[model samples]
Target chain A: MRILVCVKRVPAPGSRINVTPDSLNVDTNHLGFTTSPHEECAVEEAAQIVEQHGGGVTVLTVGPSEAEEQLRYAASVGATAFVLVSNDTGIDWDPQQTADAIIESIAELEADQGQFDLILFGNESADSGGHQVGIRVAVALGRPAVNGIKGIEVGVQGVTARREVDGGYEVYSLEIPAVLGVKEGINLPRYPTMKGRLASKKAEISARETQVAPGAQQRRRLHQPEETVIETEILGTSSDAAPKIVDLLEELGVL
Target chain B: MAGVYVVVEHDQGQLAPSAGEALTAARRLSDHLNEPVIAVVIGEATTEFVSLCEEHGIPKAVSVLDPQIVDYGPELWGQAMAELFSLTEARVVMATGTDRGNEILAQASARAQIPFVANCINAEFSGAWELTRMQWGGSLLEDVTLDTSSLFISYAHHSVEAEPLAAASATQIESIEMNLDPVLCRSLVQDRVTLSEGTTLSTAAVVVSGGRGVGSAEGFASLEALAGLLSGKVGCSRAVTNNGWRSHADQVGQTGTRIAPDIYIACGISGAIQHWVGAMASKNILAINTDPEANMVTKAGYAVIADLHEVVPAIIAEIERRRGNSTST
Candidate 1:
């Protein structure tokens, strides 16, 4: 049961995030980069599936050259292979171009080795949150796809996926060679060990380049929402604050 | 005629809140574009659904009815919506940024070979579609333009308040027949497992949320008690759910549930960007933490500089005592 996971690199926003002066991108000078939170869980889920099913995990990302850091991080954890589809144009690819590139990459990889049994993607990108790439890829591939899945169970015939709704979980059963857009709560991603880090440093990364066409959506600019300063009133220390809380709750008419 | 089309969401014939929100957004767009508002309801299209649309001042409502589409499948709904768009020739398509909304619009956009933007807070159309959309779950904003002929957009959750027109107009219901293929229905909802019965975290008036500082699953009992006293629901941060202390359904964060309560009492939460986005819509926020410099403490409207374990019980006791005094009086 070979599995493939797609991930994205985003800014690791600590307390606050600022936009560039031109409002075209995030200011990265003061920020660090990490894999999107949901995709980290997707990588972890793929690793767990391979650990139990006796297969290997392949991780891929379509981003700038610096995105190799995220791919290496996946290798350090448990992924057996890493592919970086480099976009050196310094401009973000629209969802259509990204999906097309991924589809082409999948086809080429399958031609070399064999077809993967499963494909995974984060439910949405943490930055853009377009919620389109996975569904588009699945449609183009003519495979069953389920999004916002929190739980998955692999079986002999098919796999069962669970998605959280407003008050309940909606379950779906899809055949193999299917795709899933998973959320963060699916699994807790593990950290890399010293041996794993050393192995990842020596691991080989495959880089591929593809032509990208402009799509229907074009980003014009980026801006920050007006900030509302909130002044916090500290009640007291210890249990003595209980009465103040009660009084405030009463004032808010929630008591 | 060119108009704004809204996809209405319904549950067992009752309208969902997102339906109203979508209608509100469509109305706003119609006001700017000078076009009529058209609603698309996918289901049995009962009288209730039509009447609800009429009450919201929708001039025309399209019902895409088929037996195969008893429940939602993204592909099937998307196919139906694409057909409706062609038949109606609507200019813009809109839906709320809920799970079903985003999924259906995504499929529709893909099938139509167009670009679809999700979680948009504001949209304006002069010649091209200019919009401000939420990025990183509202922590950042991106201004973008859509060069497509037909625009597809989804409103961010709680971005627009649901409002009705002053004078309701009579809605014309139009029924459309669809021949859905069985293959498109392969991803239908098989079953549903309900975690809680009533008063979900999103709809609760008051939310008492705990975080990593709560220690363990057992630590949530105090939060539950306090929530019970306040007639509220218990919510947890992503860290608590990640630690297996609570179910994902009870989590308040970007990936979980976006809650808009009257008051949100955050206990021991550090207020990460993801969690803060979900709780930012609350009318008032009270943070209880031992560390006064925590993000939650600094950004909240009021802070209690103390440990929540002791503070929660004392607050519950005080509420009960006040109730006892009133009853005796």
Candidate 2:
């Protein structure tokens, strides 16, 4: 079965993240870019699915031209094709507009090739975390969609998705032509081999320009959260600290 | 439709704490907009649930009951919410930022063709609603404006404390009938697999988490023993899960469960940005690592510079010794 995976290019955060002086976006001057963690796993999952079944994987992203790095990263892993929905405006698209642009891209691709059996997306973007684009795209496409999925089993008849709930896992069975917003830990994404990287460098990336419209939700600004000053109390060294820990636990009534 | 509404979440005949928190948020919005707070109870909206809402100072409740609504079907629940919104003309709709809460709101927003915001810590209504939403799981904050006829929002999980109002109020329950499309019920939850019971990693009062320094899966047994003594649960970092030392359900990171336990005891974790985002909500953190300069040690409220392998067993032994002495006394 054919599968499609959507990914987002986000700044690679280290120990700390600094926002732009204007509070409009992340200060990428010191940061590199990579695919969001969840989407990276989605690409891996798609590759594994195609390896088991006889099909190909297509990777798509709606970002600036530099986002091709993420698409190429997917290609290096195992994706057969890549689609970049290039937006040169340098402004982030709202969830509604992002979903619309993805829908348009999907329509165009499906027109050339048949509909993909499964579509995958990160549960949410690491940066925006709007948590709406995937579900909105699924609704617009009129397909069954489930988010926060950690496990997926593809069967001849349908697909089984498992979402980790409190104290248990909630399972859902959806037929083909379904969409899933998968979280990280679904799989351990594999590193790109030298040969695969060389192939990815030679791979042709198809680019499409999509017009974006303003949505109801508008960004006002960005700001850092007030940091709570934490005073680290060193109890003791080595095993001697155990007594202090016990005392603190007893004070907290947990002992 | 003009009043603020809170979507109540219930499981196994009891209201989720997130529901209470959502009501608290709704009450704040109600005070700001000068509107009544209404509770929208879906699925098994028993009388007991309505009374729980009343105790929280919600004077009015709308119950949408249907057989297909037994489990969380996003489409069906969203349809019910949309119908309720039209029936009550709710000005603002709020739910807790759990899996179901966010999904149902997404469905409702899509069906109503409106904007839905998730993980909002604060919201103010003055002609247009201004919201402070958590980005990257609270690592960053974004100020946004929602210019919609009707607003849909979910509170950041555990961001607001769930507290009841000072004075209890009488509640009026209104039941509504909804026509749910059969297609919406197609994706209903089919089966549930219970891995562990009692305290879960997210809701546990005390969480003992291990990371790369734990070495292997067998190394976690000691941490588990320590957690058991404290009536807590064992969690792991993304590295442990990636190494197959633990299941993804037990992974604590940006992609895994965001935990807000009363006290989180992190052992061997180096405190990467991904892991810190999930554990930042803990009321207090105690880091046990060999490296004094480890991120976890620097950021934690308390630190013990020691090898967890030795310190953990010592702590466990000390706790058991204390327990035995208390019993003998």
Candidate 3:
């Protein structure tokens, strides 16, 4: 089995995020980047599959050269190959365009390998989190697709995967050449070790473009969220009240 | 030019509540767009399915009955919906944004080759879509302009209010039989795996959630008892899962399940952005924490100044007292 895991690099989870100076897009400048935590789990799950099934793991990502870091992170988790599809077409493509590019690039990558087995991806990327790429990729590739998978195992004919539904876990099995959108808790992703990091350094990632792009735009409406965020600040009263605060804190055993 | 296309999701015979919520979204969007709503339910059932839809507020209900579609298969649902989409020029196709809803939209988006957006919290129509999309698990908002004349959008279960219309005269229902190829599909729902030992979260009305501040793994019993008294579900924070205090299934976050309950009470939870994102849409939130500075104190509908040790037991006692009072009455 040759497993392909797709990932995305976005702003680190804890870092402060900002829109561009023009208030148009996420301000990529000044923010640290890392692989989406969910994708990390997907890579770990794919690695476990290869470890048990005697196969190789390949990582796929869609972004600029900066996105190679996500692929490297996947390699550090035991992926053997890396494919990057960039849309340096002087514009940032929407989710559809990104999926199209990934669809085309995945075909070429799988064709080079001659026969592909599994395609694993995060349920949604942290930043874009479009939640469409994997499903679209499955459709574009004409393969079985499962979403929100929490657990998985390799089977004789195909693979067995478990996902969350309305009531409980929905168990499924699909033949090779299928897609799965990995949810958290599927597996505990392993941290990159010194050895795995060094192996990742040696990986020369592959990248390309796609023929399909966003065909048209739709109407409705868009804007910022209506919910208001208010910050509150309260100050302690006078010195006498400060002593009372200390007494109250002592009563609560905070002192 | 304005009409609602309700995306139906089902497993075996039971329909996901979000299916009803999808109909709600469809009705609301259609109302906003000044268009009528049409519901498309795809299943293997022959007769009962059509009436089930007609009883609901779905006018022009199209039931694509096929015997082979026993489980939720995205391709078959997408293909069937695509045929329906061709028949009707739906200005907006809305789904519940569940595992199935999101899947159908993704497949339909690719098949239709149109821009697809997921988990949209707000949408408007002034000729084009000015949309506000959640980013980084709702940590921030991305305001983008989708000029697409028509597109596929899945509303996250709790993101949009599921407001059904008042029952009017008999709703117009239409059923259409369709053809589908079961082969070329790679996966099937073999069985349902149990996540919780009891009380499916879907049935939970009032939920009491815990967080890292709960500290010890041994204290879950107290929380469980409190939840049992309220007939509610037990919820955990992502931190608790990370700490292995609870199983990941009980985790409440962006990755975890999104629920809309009558009342959500938080205990010892500082409320991370991700956790709040999942629970923010709850009808009401009451928080009890030692740290008065906990972020949720402001966000919750009500805040209590007490530790889990001191407060949860009291809440349980109150619930038991209420039950006793009701029984005596």
Ranking by DockQ: 2, 1, 3
Positional deviation of residue B237's Cα in model 2 after best superposition, in angstroms: 1.5
True contacts kept of 3: 0.41
DockQ per candidate, 2 decimals? 0.70, 0.73, 0.30
In candidate 2, what are the lDDT values of residues B1-329, reduced to their tens digit?
Answer: 48988898876457776877888888888888888888888865687787778778787888887767877767778878877777777887789988888888988887777789999999887778899998878888999987766888999888888888777888888888777887888788888899877878988999999999999999999999999999998999988988999988888988888898889999999998889999998988999999998989999999999999999999998898898999999
Q: What's model 2's lDDT at B328? A: 100
DockQ of 2: 0.73
Which docking band does candidate 1 fall into? Answer: medium
Q: Give the i-RMS of model 1 in Å.
A: 1.7
After superposition, candidate 2 runs with Cα above 4 Å error:
B327-329
- Give the winner by TM-score: 2 or 3: 2
RMSD of 3: 5.8
How many backbone clashes can be found in candidate 2?
4
